[model samples]
Target chain A: MSTSSDVDLDEVYSFALDLAKQAGKMLDDAWRARCDGGPQTGHVEKESAVDLVTQTDEDVEAFIKQEIASKFPIHKFIGEETYSKGSSKEYLIGKEPTWCIDPLDGTVNYIHIFPMFCVSIGFILDGEPAIGVIHAPFLNQTFSACRGKGAWLNGTQRLPLIRNPIPPMPQDAPKGCVFSCEWGKDRRDQPDGNLHRKVESFFNMAAEIGGRQGKGGMVHGVRSLGSATLDLAYCAMGAFDIWWEGGCWEWDVAAGICLLKEAGGLVTTANPPTDPSTARIEDTKLGGRLYLAIRPAGDTEQETGRQGQERTVREVWRRVRHLDYPRPGA
Target chain B: MSTSSDVDLDEVYSFALDLAKQAGKMLDDAWRARCDGGPQTGHVEKESAVDLVTQTDEDVEAFIKQEIASKFPIHKFIGEETYSKGSSKEYLIGKEPTWCIDPLDGTVNYIHIFPMFCVSIGFILDGEPAIGVIHAPFLNQTFSACRGKGAWLNGTQRLPLIRNPIPPMPQDAPKGCVFSCEWGKDRRDQPDGNLHRKVESFFNMAAEIGGRQGKGGMVHGVRSLGSATLDLAYCAMGAFDIWWEGGCWEWDVAAGICLLKEAGGLVTTANPPTDPSTARIEDTKLGGRLYLAIRPAGDTEQETGRQGQERTVREVWRRVRHLDYPRPGA
Candidate 1:
């Protein structure tokens, strides 16, 4: 809980990392406890039919908030569960030093013990993410970053930011680039939803990636990590070329945003960018729009410029064509 | 290594588990060694535009085969890489013991380090999975089973055999009931590619699970855990229901098939059953049909099944109308 007045940014980052480690330990303990045949006390409700919410989720969120508040009373906080109940009031740009948290990001995976879940904590100062700490306790891995400092894995290893140049579009999607997506909360209601369309776009893009040489997409494959925080962290680590999500709150992405930015990756709209610098993180949400997070594909690759990752992503977005398709040619 | 004359399944089970552990370690070392900073050093090429192959993938498969041959000379082997070169030469049923291995199931996820990858090994005696082992080395989890004996996690904790029954079909697919599938290799090149149709059907089923109550599809959610072996293990553990896959060889599922059956789960073809006894696992692949590994759901709220599990799973499966789409949509 180091504040601007009490400590430098580095000190604050170190403190955040410490808190994340502590939180990570709690999650690990909880996971083990549950695994050891603990009580089936949690409720089974689908946030989206695919997304699960249980008491453990609430418990984890409360634990993170309590620990953070007790240690650093002055820092502002916005957490997922709380935000769902009106804590989102302060997430605006130019806010006080705030820590946005998704205590257990992949709740659905955790409930099933899928092991792709994580604890994410992000620090925002003056409307921009300054430092972020994400821990996948189950995997025993941590990713952290500060604005001026480069991103690091497990504290000692410095990670380089890398993305391949958007190779020529194939007649199909590359079979390798795995796109990560969420099923969201209201898929059944929509049937032919923008999300479904988005999924189709992903398939279409993947098709293009694997399509014949003349008709392909840029990425090789797609994946849905089940957690936004982990998805961003994966993108930051160059494990994925693009991560797009809609209907997510700041807490779900706050920590990942910092890690992604620090990794020299860009998180922008899936739609064409009208303005670049003036674009704020909040802009990531306009139009229920998706955020395209691309790793920094180097100089020769950068020659593709704005049309680079941004263009490839936007092209996929536009190529989606329809959010809802007629049910099986009916 | 165990033949019927003098073979103790337990001993072979123990040996295979040991081998799994050793192989897992090798995989861990390789994974870490490859963690050096760089955009992944491989291109995803789809032969026939449906099958995907990468250099590191071939190397990993080769490394695994070499290690196994060096350690156990008599055990017959079948692997994804090997089968890629030629169709499986079925082992004599009830004859000598043989092994099936997916050196890396979920290779796409492995390439991305999405953490759902695993080294899978299934031992067959008399044409049945006698004992099976699946290890996600990076995740530090190994699921193993010996026929007539319950499955164990990391060799200590016994997994619950009863699963939550497949709930009624959701209007949208739920998130918790993960369905693991792979895009067929040479998808477009294949005949009548109903691949997209299958994907669309999956989307419908999965989306229903995540849809609103009375609206969303069955259970809580859907997931593609990347690795077929692990996905089946999860199903056996009741972590998910209805894990289906197409275009995968016995190597990708042999170990998991045993685990699922032992855990009280059921496996069937998505198509109509013609001959249940001679279901040669591949019959589940009705002209590129899908494999369904379904767990019985119970009336109890706990993971433990009470009454509804079996009937519910059967009913739900029956409800999912078979898609008539061709394998490689024409």
Candidate 2:
């Protein structure tokens, strides 16, 4: 088992970045071919009607997996396509250095030629996110991070893109915040279903600031862009103030969480803490399945980045309904 | 008052394209300045806390208005910022050569540094869309069209960017469609309010194909990108299969409608027609605050583009709730 102290994180980060770009090129070529050619894009249903998988997805994942194996044969890999195929005998994150990949993060967007899809590669060691690389070929953006080394955009600009003084979180947060969320593929209408809770929660957050019978946080705006990975990347860039999501696997968010952490953002359980005052956001787990992510904050007269994030999280938690996304093998 | 036949649409289209690019440059400069500098990017609340107006918005609109007045001295102009002010004695769309401009279409996105915002310029002659141009600087996309002429991307590639044979709409209609919508600034929570109806409609569309008890369309996906103009532009390019929106004024959609029309798409009332049998999608009024836009359909064995669009519209109408956004002068 390789620990963070013993792992060459810089080497892993460079390898991950190269592999992500290669996967991105594969995705771009397939998308362009689909546009120039015909309906031969070859997509099939996965778990449900809305859930989809494409040949390009498989091809990209295979390429990334082969590259990783050839370069670092000892490291384990967990990819979306392979995991979905029921090949996860040891799916649980062990102490060994592991790689998590989502070859095509937004497949539906890709199929429609919407230009929001990307290839994400994340490396973890000692059960902690260590390096992440996400490349969006269509959007011409690449985000990468190495723990304790900070995040970068296109290997140049630093994360949060905004360089000036960061604005402090408003006292009435989730009020002036730009909230990002997604309506996942699980659309069951039952009382406790993911769809029902998501709709209720979105309504509460978007309703009038004081409405919803005191449940409204009235965040500045709610965006559903259909890609959890990109949402996290944007949150890391300070474009999205907060991102709340569930029903997504580790591949979907692992790289994003790494980027956010390196960018000085906070990640926590999507569900409210039982004891809000005593809860530590740093205790959040990678495979938790439900996550709340808040971008770095601007320092104010009284609030530090950590304090602002905690306050904003509390306000957001008060508005969102309790979602049930049990951990795998729980 | 000039009619479409008499107006030189090509000239207007070229001018509109150049102006859109200029506006986009202005927006990009202001945005870059904000990113590099501090909180000097002056902004104030408009209509509601969620609604915002920034100095760049006003500056861009003023610049566009000046350019239009100088280039086409006889043309009328209506801009978003100017319209928001109490200077609308001639706000109503009349039978004239008028330019409808949303200098900064997605102000909230611009303020938050989201990349989905754009500059939209639409030319109307005799109450009909004649020329349109939408430029998104951050995304490096420029969409333009002239009446009776095809739409283009960055002045080169023809729209519905897919050059291969188009696939006909599926028999299931919205079942496999990529639906685009928005959560407008109206957040009232009353049963008949915009927010309540929007939430209900989103849930119904996203629910399982059979779980919503005959109400579910089980659309492939739902995206809320927050910019009606870009949504319309993307629809023209065939990235978005359908765009349903309310609470957006003519400026937000005029240019997009022109681009879609030129690209072989369709725009109809967002509300379900009172007489579905007698309804003609072509008769949809531009002043109508609610709109339903469908992208160009793929050719199939049994359907043409027009037929496919009409059929898809009917299916989507059945699933979406009626939204009331009264005409400006009604």
Candidate 3:
């Protein structure tokens, strides 16, 4: 190993890749088996439907947990199914090199058979996200990244989309932009409801001419694939110019963050859209309870300095300033 | 030809299926050619940024028009690209057979290389949507239906989703709903800006407990695939519980309506929320400048009669009551 804090990075990455495929097969089989049973067959077992979790989610998570423990032995694990039951949040930061697993990132999409969901796994080294592997079995696409070595799609193409730099920006005219957000898991209708605020802001960003408050951002469009993992992975490739959301966890974004960062994309709170470089890796875990991510500019847009990525992030963020939400449960 | 209708139903259905694939291939090829070329490559020629049209759209439309003219000879055609330039709208409601082609639906999604776009072709006989075919090459799916023959997917499975009927409703509270909507092409920020009204209403359907006038439907989730063709096709299969949209034309919803009807789904004006059975097929074109579609209730879940589908439709519509938009220039 390179240092005492290090594990064999490539070896762990390979293990993650294999584990993800194994889990994907299980999930897909469950999906196909229930396909003809109608939309409700697979969606029955749930924690208040909207924030759905099925038998398959737990089955897949348990499988991955068993496999990871058998293989890694010493690594700490923080998985979505077990996140609430254990002290995994304590394992999020530290030199223990935790592994974050989201067995199924888009459960809602899966239930509806909308064909956009994936399995995401991230390896954190000494508290810094270092390796990420995301696999969408239905779409037959996989995205993975190693900290310094670069990101890859399906084992070949580089990330930040097409492994190419973003296209050159047209002068003056705000570069045509696309932003994505989610309805999220919290369905509270209270005055402090998060969705109410999100819906208002989504309208503000997507409306034409001038949006709410006479300032529509006029983005090309907005999308919600119902999966944070795929969203972050697509954002890494620049497919989605920007993906900002709240109420998702590290498991949802950890793997994607590796691919995103390794591809030279930037991430910050969905609100207060700040310079991503300003935060330390460990200390940067959703201090604002939201995340705003942008693909680096290249001709596929070029990345100049903090200004390069920040300019687009700041520009888009200006229109969505209305999305700011109060701290959860506060 | 059957009866005095003088139309060969199967022959026209075959013609539509062939033309859809031909157009789908051309669209797919153009999509691949422009994949790595940033967002603007395929979107070079456009009416506006958000409401985009590429060279492929025109080329594909022209190709379909020529092929239909040469083979069908006497058939009238209404293709989106040529709609504004000619008197095609006059041919929309006629005893003569007319082919409505959306050369490229979800143009925005296609431009972004997002994989959610397709070619939709529908044949209307005596003003009744008879033959329908929608091909999405990237997804390797083709949905088609004939008035009495029923709908099919990939040329094998019956439409209305799988070969199976709509699932029976669960005994529990509600078999969580999954609804779909569109950002649409209209960008006017005015009160007539259907999008402004849509945004406010979408929030209402999606919010929970009490939202926007203390009435939230709390649908299982919401989706915006940005493709009306695919949205309707999926609704026919019961994939999306409900899809509400406006400002879209006949070509957009025509083909899908055929499949939905064959699948036993329901379609009505989005604003007034009328009974599909009471409306004439020709008069049923989202004349209110809107459409509300629902998947047929299957034995899998029995919510009962018009009330079954209407309950969900009315529930969601209550939140969007303010979304009334004027016809075009009004």
- Against the native chain B, each candidate's TM-score is 0.74, 0.95, 0.86
Candidate with more favorable, higher TM-score: 1 or 2 = 2
How would you encode candidate 2's per-residue C-alpha lDDT over B1-330 as one tens digit per residue?
A: 555566677778778888999999999998887777745577899878988989899999999999988988888888888888864433477897899999998787888888999999998888877788999999999999998889988888788878577656767878888888888898887877888888778787888877677878788888988899999998888888888988888898889999998888889888877765456766457777788998877777787878888888888777788898766446
lDDT of 2 at B153: 87
Q: What would the TM-scores of all predictions be?
A: 0.81, 0.96, 0.87
User: How much is B112 displaced in model 2, in angstroms?
Assistant: 0.7
lDDT of 2 at A2: 49
How accurately is candidate 1 docked according to DockQ? 0.29
Q: How accurate is candidate 2 locally (lDDT)?
A: 0.85
Tell me the tens digit of each residue's lDDT in model 1 across B75-152.
Answer: 677666766666433332345667677777766666656667787888787777778899988778889889999777
Q: Choose the strongest candidate by TM-score.
A: 2
**What's the ranking of the predictions by DockQ, best on top?**
2, 3, 1
The DockQ of each candidate is 0.29, 0.80, 0.49
**C-alpha local distance difference test of each model:** 0.62, 0.85, 0.72
Candidate number of the best DockQ: 2
Q: List model 3 lDDT by residue over B1-330, tens digit each.
A: 222167888888888898899999998877665545533455553445677777888999999999999988788888888885563344344667788889999887776667678999988887778888999987788889998887787877665543354554323212267778887656567764567678777776776655556766667777877788999998886678788887677888889889888877888767743543343332246334578887767543344634566555555555665455465432
